[model samples]
Target: MIKKLSKKLSVSLSKSLDGNNEDVEIWTYGLELLLNGTIKFGLIAGLSAILGTFKPTFLILITFAAFRCFGGGVHFSTYPRCLTFGVIKFLILGSISNVKGNMFNYNLLFYVTLFLGILTIIKWVPGDTEIKPIKNKEDRKKQKVKTTIVLILWIIIVQILIRLNSFKYILPITLGALTSFIFITPLGYWFITSIDNILDKTKVKYGEVK
Candidate 1:
């Protein structure tokens, strides 16, 4: 469906804008991204309404999506799994925040996890997928810089939300930050690879997948 829409848009752009194949390809790719984002966000919003965890879900989506976009960590190879994983992810975070409410673990576990996240970012970032692999030194450096800036900004935002000292903000924002941090780690990379492998098996069983 998305491909067809992109194709139609590309054809229209070609006629209206008098564009070439490269221009058409650019517009088609842009349309695919726009469509995919719309669907994903729509699903997220629908789930938020059903779960009654709007704020938390929104925060989780924002932080997680931001990291996943620039951090360039693990991503599901297929579109279906990506959507599934994203929904499951925000739902879990939102559910936990709703149930647990304002919680404090001002202990070593919190500090340890935060430190681990920092280490992971320093070591594994800016992570890229196999398809959108960052091959150029300049591009790689730029991505890394952006990743660092975003992570720092996220940390600052989380701290500010934490200071709010409200379950509504603190719990959701803190947990969302934690989840985002973990997703950029080697473990996240492992999980992505595992999912891809399982999808590979599924495709084989189905035979000649679309």
Candidate 2:
């Protein structure tokens, strides 16, 4: 549905603007990206409404954005797979964020998460994929350094939050850090590869690729 909508939008724009085929194709691709992103965000928002987890989910989104901005990660090959992975990821992070007071030590979790997250970033950071490789050495260096700084800043902020007894925020922040770290590892790249394989098999049986 999102793909069809995007295509229709691009076609409408092209006709109205008297665009050529190349221009229309570019517009179609951009519209697909816009629509796909909106649909995925909508899915998360709907889930939050049903689960009453808006705050935690929002925190998870913020933390995910912080590290992902510089750390980078695998991107799904197709929109459907991307949406599927995103929904699952946010669901788990949201669940973690909703854990009640004193069930587990939030402070301890924060410390552990910070350690692991920084270690992962330092060890295999600037992780790239076959389709979206980070090839420049200078670019790689900058990303790694920036990703490390983000993680460190996150730790400091979490510490301040803990001092303020903002226990509710700890879980989501820790989960976000962990998720971000995972993305900068080979595990994250393999996930995309796995998704690609699934898409390929389904396409083979259906005799078409979306």
TM-score of model 2 relative to the true fold?
Answer: 0.80
In order, the Cα lDDT scores of the candidates are: 0.74, 0.80
User: Against the hidden true structure, what lDDT does model 1 obtain?
Assistant: 0.74
Considering every candidate listed, which one attains the maximal TM-score?
Answer: 1
Worst 10 residues of 1 by lDDT: 101-110
What does candidate 1's lDDT look like per residue over 46-86, in tens digits? 98888888778887778667766776777787777888888
Which is the leading candidate under lDDT?
2
lDDT for each residue of candidate 2 in 1-210, tens digit (9 for 90 to 100): 777887788889989999988988889888887787778888898897688887888788888878888888878777777788888889777976777867357767776777878677767777676756888989988998998888878878887887898888888877887887777778877877787887799899987764
For candidate 2, give the lDDT: 0.80
Using alpha carbons, what is the TM-score of model 1? 0.87
